[model samples]
Target: MSSRPKAKPHFRVSPAVLGPLGIEQLQDPALAVLELIKNSWDADAKRVKIVVDQRKAPGKILVNDDGHGMALAEFKERWLVIGASYKRALEKSEGGRPLIGEKGLGRLASFALGNTITIQSARESGRSFLADVNWEELSSAASLEEYEVKIRRGAVTNGTRVEIHDLKGAWSSDHTEFLVAHAEFLASVPGERFHISFKVDGKAYRVKHALATINRLAEGSLEMRVAPDGTPTIRKCVINGADEKRIVFRDMKSDELDPTLAGTRLSLKFFRRDEAARRLSGVLQRNEVTEVLERYQGIRVFRDGINVPPYGLNRDDWAGLEQQRTSTGGPTLVPGNSQLVGELHVSKRAQPHLVITAGRSGFADQAAVNALAKYVRWTVRALGTARRAEHLGISEANVRVPARIDEGKDRPRTASPQTIRAALTAISRSEVVRANPALRKKLEDASQAITETLGQSEESLRLYAQLASTGIAATSFSHELRAEFDVVSEAIAEVAASSRKPDKELIDLLSTSWGRILAFAALFKVVPVKIRRHRKTMSVSELRSSAETILGLASPDKVTTELTIPAMRLSIVPAEVDSILLNLVSNSVKAVAESTNRESGRIRVRFEAHGNDLAIHVADNGCGISRSVAQIMFEPLEGKFAEGTGMGLPIVRYIAERYKGAAAIVRPPASGFATEFVVTLRNVVQ
Candidate 1:
């Protein structure tokens, strides 16, 4: 029994063709970057410089390596073949190092980034060679076009160069800044002589080395990191200075170096561009670093320098993580799939279980790795959650000192940590706790005044805890707390004025401090935000005051403020009246704040009381709501300078209806102004 009849050639010879490919399909920039970097590695380059020039128009990505040059044959058949297998066959022969590039498809990566690609290589074997490919031609054809990439026999010395031009993606100021932000990864590699350069509009990329630079902008700051299974260390970092090499980690505390230091721990890296000349993780690209980061800014667990793959810090109980303050200093995992970042130092002797990767820089593909990844995700989730009750307390120490209020009432140009600290303090005090002595004293007296007012602080505290648990902020909470703080802090100042202390100057200074603190805290007041789960509050009196203020703004200036229910307060869900009030009043104020005639721009507010409802009427004598503004009052609209997001009246209407109310903008009364507003509330709350 022999095999079946001899196989015959097919009736016709079929043409073999390469499959379709697109540059846009390059999913992982890390993998694409590896392709460029690997060529240098293959050249046996001791030093390579990666430069990314993202100027105004089309950016150019250049990779130049001082490695061995390419020979003619290697350039044509081996270098240009898609999915070529030259490494396995040649490994036993020349050089004998394992090849970083096995599949030839890596060369295709340039297509994803740009349309024009050029490669230049020099060989000690002979002269340098240059090969270029225009991908537009490739992508334009219905079928694959084979272009022979041959080595140029002329010009330069031994080395390889690749430059991709005509960038597929447009460069924006944002993208340029992003590249700069990740610039730290540029010069980061230990025990290696590689340099990465980035330029935006011709300016060299740089990093603000001080950890304090981050502190300068955050409302709250905490710069701490944790390491795996070892003692941690902490070191003070002034905003723009460097630390004196006293190794610090979460596992090891104290500046004193332990001669017997062993095991894993978090290390705070202070960047010194002119000195260390090393990248934090010893990696050269942003994508490479991102590959190991958990959703949070924390890095993956590395056992002996190898990454613990799919799962990271989750499994290594002693894994590296940080608290979530302003910088990577604290542990915080925000929403969205962020870039992988941060470095966790490790060495060869870490436990076998810890070394999740199978000797490579990847994690071992086992259930443990999955568990670890999940653990990392869970830990990140816990930073703002599971640990809130505990972590919130610890983070209070990181609040920054507040800024001095300057004239003009404009907000600080930068996001100061003090701002966040003040907001937190006020929230915690009036809306959450009466820990502050002055606030505590008010609560003590409120209890003496009556039973109703005493429960307010407890209610604020209860609401605060609820917000903390759900990560939802209530708008009423801010107003309630602010008003309470304002009233209470004012009371404290009065009570303190009578104290004839041993030192009159010290007492006066304390009084000034109280006033400044109270005023600073009040500035935290913000426009209501009703994002999902967010609570926006507009109190009845606040609405009336704001509206009256705006209505009084007339060119002739006749708008004035008069409250009918001076002490009354109601909660409006959305802000129909608020929007109309803001638009009318602001217009009124603008028309009047610098008026020549209508002396005091007069705006009137009268609330007509009914059993369960009320009618609020506002009349202004300033420039009335223009037809243009009335038509689009709360709707976000695009126009010239200060063009409205148009959230005014629409938001007001939404709020009015939300709280069972109706708002209308009608033609104004005679002399003073040309605007009238009638807000009908179904049920007004006190």
Candidate 2:
């Protein structure tokens, strides 16, 4: 047998690969221009200008920068290379600016904007040269080496100029505005000396960073610094300018966080949109402030004072702030994305593991990125807690809730209802409270009420959990039961067809009874399962009709109900609104039935328009609630009535808060009613 000789083969690439590497690498023309500007920044350019000439068809774009330009040899070796980044060996430029381009394909981003690009460079001591490339020609070539770039010597200043011709799409005023906005953001990067200017059709556009103004007008802010070892400290926290306090979190370690997050700093500014508009009225209009917030609301990532793409954009929820806002038990605690703007600062020199994606869309999916997200979420939670404490005039120490309980075992246990009750008892009997008779009495009363409410809540939660489990089984059971019923129905029809008159009548009765039983089973199956609801726009008449139908099914025949709704449309989740009404009306009916002297029971549900908000007034003529009980009525399981589970009002309040509104007991109840509850749905009409 003969042995085969070994052969070596090399990889050859066609110019067609540039389609994905350059033309399709960036879908947006504005983003491609930004990439070119970043290259100028990396070159230590002190001044950069971008001109978009749209006065004629097939317009051209010119980007000029005064920086350290490349010579003929450097251009041929570095600029012509694809995917071989010279920046991989250099951490910073000669002028000490942090290098921004790493993929080496940023120059090719020009292909996304146009087919032809002409580049002219003039070095300080070397001969200036110009190179022209036609992407279409290169793309059609069989191999990368087949395409040629026209080169010529040039007598120009020390800088670089790029002219893109044969535009892919028409540049409109909207595109110019987009570039202008991006330029303002770029210029706003801290510690960056590079300046960028924009011109549309030879008209110079001024850039004003609105973020600076927003930062100044923010109502609440949190600034934190994390050490290399993962120890986080609050540098400054202004919850409310009127009264500020320092908040501290104890025993937190970076063990769970990625070590790459070391030395990361985060600063968040929160704005109550309406309040911010009022404060900025002298400087910016309400709509302008709104537009600014809408454009830049999420937390952005900045590495070495350079803005990263796709993080803070309107559509980006990289930090999951919007998700948290809609998560279970988060509506009241977490602020929506539109209410916040923040910056997460990392360094290329310090946190090297935080690598950017190849496409430059965002950071790579690694432990460091996940750790960054976790840290941001924790910071948001802390800021929210501090803000709430300040607003309520509560001490930061009192606001801290135990996350877990020490069970005197190998593993700590989550705090249970019993543990919370025991802790409340201990608090009421503390020495400080016991020393004062008045305070001691108040504390005892409060503790007792809280204990009772806790018990009721625990019981209700247990039952709801059981019901959810049962619902799963009931769904399957109902299907089978329906099939059996259908068989019985068919058998009855057969018997009626072959029997005498009396026997036929008996069979018909049995079928009707079987049908009623099947209907009951279907109703039973639905009772344990919660309906998933989606928000939809409905007219006033539609909403009214739906409410009436719900009331007819849920309300007692003995009680009279009246609904008054404004003649306007609303966007709401019908199921949520139904839940709110059912709970309120049920409570009122109970109150009326237990009244000492009442000829008739009446419940009035009136919807009133308060500016952009929708106020739902539920009033009833029933045994009135006392000032004391009414004060805590909306609290979970705070109802004092014997037959009440006390969870109804809390559920109502939760739904209201989910809509950025509140549920309150209206004191001095509405005329002709004994007790009144008002649930406001914020901005429902708008």
lDDT, candidate 1, equals 0.41
> Per-residue CA lDDT of candidate 2, range 63-128, in tens?
999989888888999988888888988888888877788878888778889989999997784568
What stretches of model 1 exceed 4 Å from their correct place? 1-22, 25-61, 76-78, 83-106, 140-145, 180-183, 206-342, 345-466, 470-686
**Weakest lDDT window of 10 consecutive positions for candidate 1:** 321-330
Give the per-residue lDDT of model 1 (tens digit) for 364-471.
Answer: 444443333333333233222212222222223344212112224563332233433333233334522343567445333333322222223323333432332232
- Measured against the true structure, the TM-scores of the candidates, in listed sequence, are 0.40, 0.57
Worst 10 residues of 2 by lDDT: 472-481
RMSD of each: 18.0, 24.6
User: Local distance difference test, per candidate?
Assistant: 0.41, 0.66
